[model samples]
Structures are given as C-alpha cells and as structure tokens.
Target: MCNFKLSSSPSSLLVSTTKNHFLISPQPSSSSSMDPQPHDDGLHRWPTPQEALEEIKAIGKISGPTAITGLLMYSRAMISMLFLGYLGELELAGGSLSIGFANITGYSVISGLAMGMEPICGQAYGSKQMRLLGLTLQRTVLLLLSTSVPISFIWLNMKRILLWFGQDQEIAAAAHTFILFSVPDLFFLSLLHPLRIYLRAQGITFPLALCSAGSLLLHVPLNFLLVGYFRLGISGVAMAMVWTNLNLCLLLCLFIYFSGVYRDSWVGPTSDCLGGWSSLLALAIPSCISVCLEWWWYELMIMLCGVLVNPRATIASMGILIQTTSLVYVFPSALSSGVSTRVGNELGAGRPARARKSMIVSLFCAAGLGVAAMLFATAMRHRWGRFFTGDEEILRLTAVALPIAGACELGNCPQTTGCGVLRGSARPRIGANINLGSFYLVGMPVAVVLGFGLQMGFAGLWLGLLAAQASCTVFMLRALTTTDWTLQAERAKQLTAATNNQSSPPYPPFDKQSKAAAAAKVASETFCSGDTARDGCSIEMEPFIIIVKN
Candidate 1:
C-alpha cells in the first residue's frame, strides 16, 4: 500500500505511491471526467470561459470613464491657457512655456511611474499573491518619493535650464517663478500617482474619473478668480495647479482608506520589503531617463519652431496642434490602459495564449478608432483650427497642418497600444529604445533639414514628425505580432513560483520522496522550459536555482 502526505504550500502537492499514474478526483459538483491527474500547481491552471468573459466585461466597463476623465483634465488645462492668452501675448507665451516645463517635470514623471505600476499590480493580482501586490505598491511609493528630491533640485534651477534653451530674460523669469511655486508639486503628484495606479490595478477606474472631474470643476472657476479677477497673472495659474493637485491627492487618499483596501495587512511602510534604497533606484532611474528622453524630443521640436519666423505665432499654433492632438489621444490612451491590465493579468495567470489574443483584440480596436479619428479630423480641418485662435493667418496655417495631423493619428493607435503591451510584460526598455531610435535617429533630423534647411516651414516640420510616428508604428506592430506566448507563459510561471517560494517556505525539500512528488506536480503543471517534452517536467535553474533550493 502507498501513502500520500498533503503539503501546505499551494504550489506543490505530495502523493506517495508505487503506482505510475495518479488519479485527480474532481469535486462532487465538478463535471470533469476521472482520468490522468492534471496539474496541481497554480501556474498551469487556466481560467474558465466564464472568467475570461468577466475579465473582458471589466475591461469594457472602465474604458468610457477613463476616456472622459482624461478629456476633462486636459480640457481644464487648455482653458487655463486660453484665459492666460486674454491677458497679453507676453502672458500667453510665458504661461505656455512655464506650463510646458511643469508638465514635462511633474505630470510626465508621475505618468511614467504610474505606468510601471500596472504590470506589477496586475501580475500580482492575477497570480493570487495578494501580499506581494501590497509589497509592490509600497515599494513603488517609496521609490517615487525618494526620487522627488533630485527632481525638486532640478526645478529649483529651472531658470538656468530655460536660459540654456535661449528663452529671453522675461520668459525665463516667469518660468523660474512658476517653477518655485510648482516644483514641490513633484512630490504631491508622485504620491497621487501610486494611489491612482492602485485603483487602476484593481480594475476600478471610475474613482479616478470622478476625482479628475472634481478637479476640473474646481480648476476653471479658480483660474478665473486668480488670473482674470485677481490679476495674479502667471502666478495665479501656478496657484491653481497647486491647489488642484492637493485636492486630488486628498480625495484619492480618502477613497483608498474608505474602500478598506488599505487595511493593516496591506498598507504600511515598505522599508523592510524594499530590500534597500538601491533597489528602488534601480527601478526608478531607468524609467526617469526613458520619460525624459521622449519628452525632450518634443521640447526640442518646439524650440526649433521658436527659431522660425514669427516665433510667438509659430509656437502658439504648434501648441494648439499639440493640445488638439492630445485630446484625440484620450481614446487610444484609454485603450492602452485596458490592454496593459488585460495583458498583464493574462500573462501573470500563465495564460500566454489568452494574452496574445487580448493584444490582437486591443490592436484591432485601436486601429479602427484611429481610422475614425483620421476621418473626423480631416473633415473638420477648415474649422478645427478656429477653436484655439481666430487669427486668419494662424487659422490658415493650421488648416494646412490639419491633414498631416490627421494622418499622424493613424500611427498613434499602434504605437501607444504596443507600448502598453510591452509595459505589461515588464519590458519597458524595449519600447523606450524604439522611441529613441525612431524619434531621434530618424524623425528629428528629417524635420530639421526639411523645416529649416529647406525652409518648408511648419508644413515641412510636421511632415518630418509624421514620418517618425509612422516608423514607430510599423516597428511596434511587428514587435507585438511576433511575441512568443508559450515562452512568455513559461517564464511567467517560473517567476511566480520563485516569488512564491521566497515569500513562504516550500512544502518539501529535494529528498527522494519530496523529489518524486515535486517531479509529479511539475509534470502535471507542464512545467518545462520548452513547449514540447511532454510528461517530463523541467524546472529552470538559471535565475532562481539557489532560491528554489534554499
């Protein structure tokens, strides 16, 4: 007679017997047939059709709210710019420059960090490692906070940076003042980012939407009171930003507390799990550089526009184009979030096939939307530029730029969606590198030569940008299409198992009896490096051999 001992760890189950075949008896209500034992470890377990359908529904539910929130936030910011323009050209130019600086320094960094959280949280949630999910959230917060110090110092020196870019004295002074009032926002914004990401990871996006709407509602009236009525000018815009962020931070914190998501077990300092300050920096530094590189490229383009004839009008018109395009981008951006969560969750759950399917669906949806936006922008080209300005010359120039802008939307969908897919797979470096190559190596130089060297003006400049975006889209699509889901699934499974072992003790060590049971469990789970090699489970030893053995 053979005996079996059940182990405590969910990853490994032990059964002792002389027989070669193990029977996996289903529960009384389960309809599964009694046959060869299936995998007992969690990695190889697949979601039921019902579960997949639920996930898809959840993705759909959040998309609309996400889009609306993005639209509202951006619209409020645009309204601020419009109001500032009414004061004077100097005020308008200064406000635009300062806001650009603040966005690149504050919002861009927060958004990038928030992007990193999606994959980590989604994976942890899907793998059923709830404690690790909490740990990841804590670590991300610590990481963002620690980095805020250096970012603050950089903001303190904003005058010098703008001077280097050849901004006149008055412009530099306005930018410096705004930086002084706004630099501290980096920390506040950083705090808000993790909270937003926390809600997003749980598939609860409506709260963020509501909070954004609340901020928008408050920002406009406050802007009118400060800049228009009080004559605080640029300083008023700065104050509005500060108060709005504070409001958002407070609201989100309350939401987290009230939702009971931050109980004693989940919420606390991460000093212990952080492993040390170096670990946090290791994740954040690369991400910071990545975002800076992308934003700086656009900043460079804007600077180049300033060197052209009618610098003020050139910059202003381009600003309108940028903001308008950004508004349209809300759709693709929302879809990207959906893709990130879906792909990350599926990958974490060891369902690479499902992850692949989700990516395709997301890509198709994004492409269809992109086409629709292109048609809409083209049809409205004559009237579209009037929304930002009424100057006949500016409007005329913008009309010519519209078709190119509309065409640029075609590339937006694939590139943004591909970025989301890569982030979900915990491979942001790949997307970052692609952007660097496409924008800097290929796109910028073309725009410079055509716009300035050839004197093609704004038309030439946009053509250059369009080329870059198209190239990026092509490369990203190829990358997405070529992903090897089977390999990804194996890697994900190994990573999850290793994380599990580290967090808790293994049920049995590699003794004769334990090895036999471990081998059986691994086999049933299809735990092999290669997709083939049926019936024999092979545990990867490269990354976690020591940890697994220990």
Candidate 2:
C-alpha cells in the first residue's frame, strides 16, 4: 500500500524525474547502416532533493515490505534454532552444522540462481513488457528445478560427507537427519525466490510480506509441536521449515492467479519460455556465482569451527551467532533487493541517470543502517546470547563473536547493495569476478591460516570474514564510481526494445495505431541515390523495421 507512483503529479513529471527522456524512442530507420537517431536529452540528470526524497521513498516502499518479508523468513530460521537450543547442546550443535551445509549447498544456491530474475523481471516491468514477466518466471522455475536435482543428491549424502571431513560422528548423523527432511524446502525456495523478485519489481511487496508473516507466525507454533511435543529435535525443525516455505509459496501463487494486477503477465506457461532460456541462463549462472561465493564463505567458516577446540560449544555458539548476523543482514539485503528493482526498472524504462540516483541513495541508506547494526550488536554482545541459550559456555563464545559479526556487517551491507546495482545494470559478471577475488582468493587463505595455522581459532575466522568483506566493498565502490551512465542508458533502451520486438503487445504501447504510424513514417523515407549510398546509406528492407534501431 505504500507503493509510490513515480509521477505523483503532472507538474511533478517535469519537476522530478520525468519519463520524458524516453518519450520519443526513435523508430529504427529501415536502412541497415542507419544509426539510432540521437535525442535532445541523452540521459536524465540527478534529481533535486525533493525529487530524490520521493524516489527514495519509492525505493523504501519496496524495501520496507521486503525487509519485513526477509525478517519473517530470517525469524523462521532463528526460531527453529532457538527451539533446538532449548532442547539441549547436542541438538543445537547438530542443527547448526546441518543448517550450515544446507545453506551453502541448497538455499544459497537456489537464492543465487533466483537472482537471475532481478534483471529480467525488473527490466520487463520497467519497460512495460508485461508478457515477458510471466515467460521469464516460467523459464526460471524450469531452470531451478533442473539445478535442484544434484543439490538434493548432495544433501541426502551430507552425513557421509561430514563424517568424511572428520566431523563429530553424532553431530554428523544428526545433521544428516536434519538436511534429509529439509530437502523439500529447497524446491519450495526455488519457486519462492522467483516470485519474490517478480513481485518486488512491480512494487508489490505488501502481499508478500503479509503472506510470509502469516506463515512465519504459524512456523513458531509448528516448531513448538514438532520439537517440543513430538520430540523430533533437529529433524522436526527441518519439517517446520518445509511447511513454512510451502505456505508462503502457495499464497503468492494464489495472489498472482486472482489479483489480476499481475494477470496480464501470465498467459499461462508455454514453449515461448524456451526462447529466453539461454539469456536467463547467462544471467543466472553469474548471479549464482556472485551470491554463492559470499554466502558459502561464511557458512564454510562456521563448518570450520566444528573442528576447533571444544567443538560443541564453538559450533553451538555459532549456530546462534550466525542467526544474529543473518537477522541484522536482512536490512542490507532488503536494500539491495529494493535498489535492484528500482535500477532495473529505470534501466528498462531507458532512464540510466535515474537508476544511478537510486543506487547512490541505497548506498547511503546501507551505510547508516550498517553502522546502527554495528553499534547495537556491540552494545548487546555480553547479554544477547542469553536470548538463545542458558549454556554459559555457549553464551560466552557467542558474546566474543558478536562484536566481530557486527564489524563484518559494516562492510557487508554496502557490498551486498552494490551487487544489486550491478545486477540491475545487467552486469552480474563483474560482481562474480569481484567475489571470486575477495572471498576465495583473499578471504579463504586468511581464514585458514588464522583459524588453524595461527591458532587464533574463532576470532581468526571472523577476522578473515571481515577482511573479505572489506575487499569486496572496495571493488564494488570502484564499479559504482567508474560506470558510464550514458552508455548504460543506451544499452537499457536496446535491451528493452529488443525484447519487445520478439514478444508483442503488453511489452510496449506500440499497438495498432502506433505500429501503423511507425511503419508508415518509415515507409515514406528513402535511401539516398546509390552514389550517395557509397557515402553511407542503404536501401530500406520490406516491413520497414528500422535496422539501425535505437
């Protein structure tokens, strides 16, 4: 309901960021050598403070709801762990290990894969390519289902894998049990992630937050029955997750079916989806690499803690500590998703400078929120662990790690938001390159040496994570600063128009009359004489599609 339309008033259109820059997209001249006709305005300029505030509100309107949705989802995981903590140290430790494995291998993978939708769906909605949205969703679902097969195999074999890695045998067995039951949640997430992106791109986040909240509210009681009453322990926690995810997925699907606001995009599934598969795959693969690299680094750090001195206390404490970081992280992640939607939409709408403005606002917001998270976590370090467990040792360990988690978040918030900017600009590969360098090339070596070689243990691992985040932040800042805004705007227009050329109607207002005018206008134009053609001109082709299309 907080959704703010970009042009709040007719006067605002000129006073603020107007859609004017894109009003007269030149019809491509039929000549093969024709160049895109230049417009009076090449790109939008930065908005005034009042205009920036309105657009920032537009971003936050999406962010506020998605942030709540993320919080609900985060709470579901933390509650399950909180319940496990109450059960005993063994269940907590086992649940922690199983969760780490599932996140690194399953949820993170699916999440990263789903990010492929941000650009496609966001740009489609921005460009008003309504039909492309539904087709993109179909293609995404197909790809996610295909990827889940191998991940499922790995989850089913997690116990053996953990044991092979010399994990505590009992913890390994319990972790395996938890992951086995959690496999169904993986498929649900595949559907959920795509839906989340599609809806957010349209600035429809209230329903998603509503649905997730209801299910997450139900999740608490379900966890109570499974873990507290049935005594299913960590496996029971996994069952609760499956149900919670299914509830959210089903509700969003139902909304899309009945709301009719998004119905224009859904013409039912079709083979037309196959056409976009390669493009989606191209975006998806890099997105997965970028996101998973960062997600896996942290989860791996937790797994490494399993081999440290007093493994049970360290792992159990991390189970809670990781949840804490995840809780605070939702704010930045939501900002990233929010800005991705805004930027992609703007780019799709052929407003590159508008996208640039949104990115700047998001970075400032992330920085302020990150600083707040740091201070809160630091202030609560000594007392915060009591919220999860009564074990004095677990509490002590968690307290020591909380400060480090807090500091890591400062770098992480902006880096995460920066990735969103890259995704919206259709440059996921840059993020992948940066992540590969920061986490794997630099962060991992530091973590390994400090955690084991230097015998610094848990603190050393946190330091490693901190260093990786800082490195990533530096790269993202450079990417943001160095990008060419005008070129990106041109690319945005081409991609949007190109997509509409293949898929008709809802993607563009170039309906019958507009089409007739465009065709007739081009049909009236002519190539220069053959002698003049030598200067730089070509004959028009039939149907009159401008070859040098803008």
In model 1, the worst 10-residue window by lDDT is: 1-10
Per-residue lDDT of candidate 1, residues 225-314 (tens digit): 998799887878777887888888888777666655555228356354554223223234444555666667667778888888887677
Supply the global lDDT for candidate 2: 0.72
Tell me each candidate's TM-score.
0.79, 0.80
- Stretches of candidate 2 above 4 Å error? 1-47, 86-88, 227-234, 307-310, 389-400, 449-455, 497-550
Local error of candidate 2 at 357, Å?
0.7
Candidate 1 Cα deviation (angstroms), residue 546: 15
Say which candidate scores most in TM-score: 2
Q: Model 2: per-residue lDDT, tens digit, 1-550? A: 0001111122211211333121111111122121122222323345467656765776777777778887777777778867887878788778877887887888777888888777878888877788988878877888898889899999999988998988889999888888899888878887888888877877777777778888988998898898889988788888998998898899988776655545567756666766545456657877888778877776777668878999978877876777787777787877887888888877777666667778877888888887988899899999999987799989888888789888888888888888888888766767888888888888899988998999989888888888888888887888787665555555555454544344321223334555555444332321110111111111111111222222
Compared with the true structure, model 1 gives a TM-score of 0.79
Q: After superposition, how far is residue 25 of candidate 1 from its true place, in Å?
A: 32
Candidate 2 colliding pairs, count: 3
lDDT at residue 97 of model 1 (Cα atoms)? 80
